[model samples]
Target chain A: MAETRQTELAHADSRESVTPLGPVRRSRDLRVYLVVLGGVMMLADLSFIFWVAPTDSILGDIQRVFYFHVPIAVMSFLAFFVVFVASIVYLVTRSPAWDRLAQASAEVGVVFVTLALITGVIWARPIWGVWWTWEPRLTTTLILWLIYVAYLMVRAYAANPNQGARYSAVVGIVGFVDVPIVYYSVIWWRSIHPSPVVGPLAQANALEGTMAAVLLFSFITFLILFVFLVAQRMALRETEDRLGGIKSAMRRRAESVF
Target chain B: MVLVWKDILLEVRSRELVISVLVFGLLVAVVFNFALDVTPQRVTAIAPGILWVAFAFAATMAMSRAFVREREQGGLEGLLLSPVSRDAIFLGKALTNLLFMLLVEMVLLPVFAVLFGFSAMSFTLIGTIVLATLGFSLVGTLFSAIAAQTRSREIMLPVLFFPVILPVIIGAVEASTRAIGGETTVGLGRWLPLLAVFDALFLVICPWVFSFVVEE
Candidate 1:
C-alpha cells in the first residue's frame, strides 16, 4: 500500500509537469493561424465599410452602420455558440482544451457584443432619433453583453483554476440558452429593430445582388476573424498558465534551498 | 425527497432567511411609497409593480443564502456525497426558497395594500405574484448554485442572475400591471401563460445544468 501510494503521487506530479507542454505547442501553432486570419478580416472590414457598399443607398447614410453592426452581431452570436459547444465538450470530456476554448470564445464574444452595442447606438441615433432606447433587441443585446461580462468576472475571481473554469463553463452554457430566447422574445414582442431578414424562404429571395455579395463576404471575413481572435487569446492563456507553473516551481525550489 | 424536506426543516428552524427577507420587503415597500409620489389615485396603478420589485429584490437576498449557507458550513460537499439525485437537491432548494419568498410576499401584500390604499384580496393579483415568484426563485436557485462555486460568489450572484432573468421580470411586471389595473381576464391571459412558459423552460433546464455546476 505504501509503495502504491508513492507511485501514484509520483505519477500525478509527472503528469502535471508534462501537461503544460502540449498546450504550449498547440497554442503556438494557433497564434500563427490567428495572426494571418485577423489580418484578412481587418482588410475585409475596411474595404466593405469604405469602398464596396454604396455610401448613399436607399437606406441612406445610416447604411454605414450595417457594415460594422451586422458583422459584429454575427460574430458575437457565433462566439457565444462556440462557448456553448466548447462548454458541452468540456463537461463531457473533462478536457482542458475545451475549457480554454470556452474561455477564449467568451472573451471574444464580449468584445464583439460591445462593438455591436456601440454600432447599434450609433445606428439608432440617426435612424430612431435616440442614442438609447428600451427596445427589445437593444435591451436583450445589452443583457447578453452583461451576462458574458459577468461570466468573465466569475472566471477571474475564482480562487482556484479548476473552480473558475468549471463555474464559467456553466455560465457560458446557460447564457447561450438565453440567446435564442432573446431572439424569440424580440420576435414575440413588437420591437423597433427590424425583424430577422434571413428567415427560411425569405433568406434566399431577400438577397439578390451586391447586397447579398457584400453581406456574405463580410460574414465569412468576420467568421475568420473570430477564429483568429480565439486562437491568439488561447495562446496568451497558455503562456500565462506556463508562467504560473514556473513561478510555483521556483517558489518550491527556493523553499527547499532555504 | 427526504433530503429536500430536511433542507426545508433546517431553514425553518433557523428562520434567518425568512426574517431578513420580510424586513427587507417591508422596507422596499416603504421606500417605493415616497419614490413614486404616492397618492390615493396613483397608488393603485403602480402598486403591483412596487410590490413585485420589493419581493424580487428581497427574494434575491433569500436566494443568495441558499447555497452560501451550505458553503459556509462546508456541508455542500458532504451533501453531494450522499445518494440524493442532484436534481432533487436543486428542486428541493428551489421550492423551499420559493415558499419562503411567497411567505414574504404574503406579508408584504397586506402591508402594501394598507400603505397604498389598495385591496389585497384580488385573487388574480395573488396568482400573478405566485407564478412570478416561482419563476424568479427557480432561475435564482440555479444561478445561486453556480455563483456559490465562485470566489466572489455573493456579489456575483445578482450580477449574473438579474440580467438573465429580465424576461421573467418583464412578464411578471406586465402581468401584475394588468391585474392591478382591474383588467382581470386579459391580464391573466397575457402574463399567466408567459410565466408558465418561463417556469417550465427553467424548471427543465436548471436542474440538468445544476449537476454540472456542482460536480467540480
Candidate 2:
C-alpha cells in the first residue's frame, strides 16, 4: 500500500516534469532545435578540424586529432561533475528526478570518456610510439571510467529502483572523490620512471593562432553537443520511468478487478 | 566501542574470517612467487609489490563479508533500532575490518620476511601498513554495506572497492619499497602522509553517506 502511494506520487511528479500527453511531432519539440543547432556547429567544427586548422609543420595532420580529443576530455569531466552533484542532491532530497539526472549524466560521461581514451591513443601511437602507456592522466581517466561503470552496475543489480538510486548515489559520491587521489598517486608512482619525451596534451598550450581559434570553436561545439545529448537522455529516462509506473498501476488494477 | 566488541566476540567465537583470509594471503604470496621470476637479484624491487598485492587480495575477500552476518541474520535492523547512530555502525564495521586486516597482515609479515629475506617488522613498514589499511577499510566497509544489499552481493564488493582504493595500493607499495629497500635517508617520505590524507578525507565522507544508505 505504501509503495502504491509512492508510485502515485511519482506518477504526479513525473506528469508535471514530462511532455504533454499525445504523439508529439519531432519538429515541435525543443530537442529537435538543439539537435539541429548541434549538428550544424559540429559540421563546422569537423571541417575546421580537418581543413581549416593549420597542420603542424613537424607532426603534420596527425596533430589534428587534438581538436576533438581535448574538448572531449574536458566534456567528460563536466559530465561526471554533474553526476556527482546530482547524486548528492538526490540523496538529500529523496527525489527521483535528481537521480534520473545523475543516471543521464553518467551515461553520457562514459561515452565521452571512451572517445577521449580512443583519441588519446590515436595521438599517442605516433607521438609516444605506443598505443597506450600508464601516463598519469590517461590512467586516471581510465579508472574514472571503471568507477562510473561500477556505479552503473550497482544500480543494475540492486533489488529495486529506489535502492538502486540510493546505492548508486553513494558510489557516485565516493568515485568522484577518488579521481584526484588516483591521479596524484599514479603521478607519484610514475615519477621513478623516465618521463615521456612528449605527449599530445603537452603541446596544447603552444597552439598557433588559427589553430587556437579552431580549438576554441571545437570546445563550444562539443559543449552544445554534450548539453544536447544529456538533455535528450534525461528526457528518455523520464519517459521510461513514467511508463513503468503506468504498467505497474495497470497490473494492480487488473488484479483487483479479477 | 561496544559494537566493535560485539564484532570481536563473534569473530573470536568462530575464528572463521581472519584465518581463511590469512591462508588466502599466504597463498597469494606463493602464487606470485611462482607466477613471477623472483630472482635473488630482483627481490628488493619485487618484494613490496608482492606483499601489498597479497594484502589487497586478502582485503577484498574479507571485506565482502563485513556485513553478511548482520544482514543475513537480520540483525542490522535491530542494531539500527538501538541507540547508536548510523555513523557509529559504519565506524564500528570499519574499525573491525581494520583490526582484522591488520591481524592478517601482521601474521603474514613473518611469512613475507622468510620468503623475501627482508625484515618485515620494521617501524616504517608497520606504519605504512597501518595507514594504508586505514584507508582501505574506510572505503571497503562503505562499499561492503552497499554491496550486501545487492543481488550479487559477494561478486559486487571488489568491483566497487578496488578502483576507489588504487591510491592506497600505489601509496603502500611505494612506501614499503622505500622501507624495505633500506633507504634510511628517504624512508617512506611523502607517500605516508599522502596515505594519511586519503584516510582523513574518507573518514569524514563515508560515514555521512552511510546515514543516507540506511535511511529507509
Segments in model 2 whose C-alpha atoms lie over 4 Å from true places? A1-28, B184-187
Quote the chain B TM-score of every prediction: 0.94, 0.97
Model 2 residue pairs with clashes: none
Which ten contiguous residues of candidate 1 chain B have the minimum total lDDT? B182-191
Best by TM-score: 2
Candidate 1 per-residue lDDT, tens place, A1-258, comes to: 699556644544454452646767876777677778768777976777678766544447676677668888989988988999998899789888788899999999999999999998887776666788766667778888999999899889887888788778878887777766655555444432345322223222544367667777788778778888888787777667655665566556558759
lDDT of 2 by residue, B1-216 (tens): 998999999999999999999999989888999998788878888999999999998998988888888888888899899999899999999999999999999899998889878877678889999999999899999999999999898878989999999999999988998888885536267799899999999999999999877766
Say which candidate scores most in lDDT: 2
C-alpha TM-score for every candidate? 0.87, 0.94
All models, DockQ values?
Answer: 0.61, 0.90
Cα lDDT listed for each candidate: 0.77, 0.88
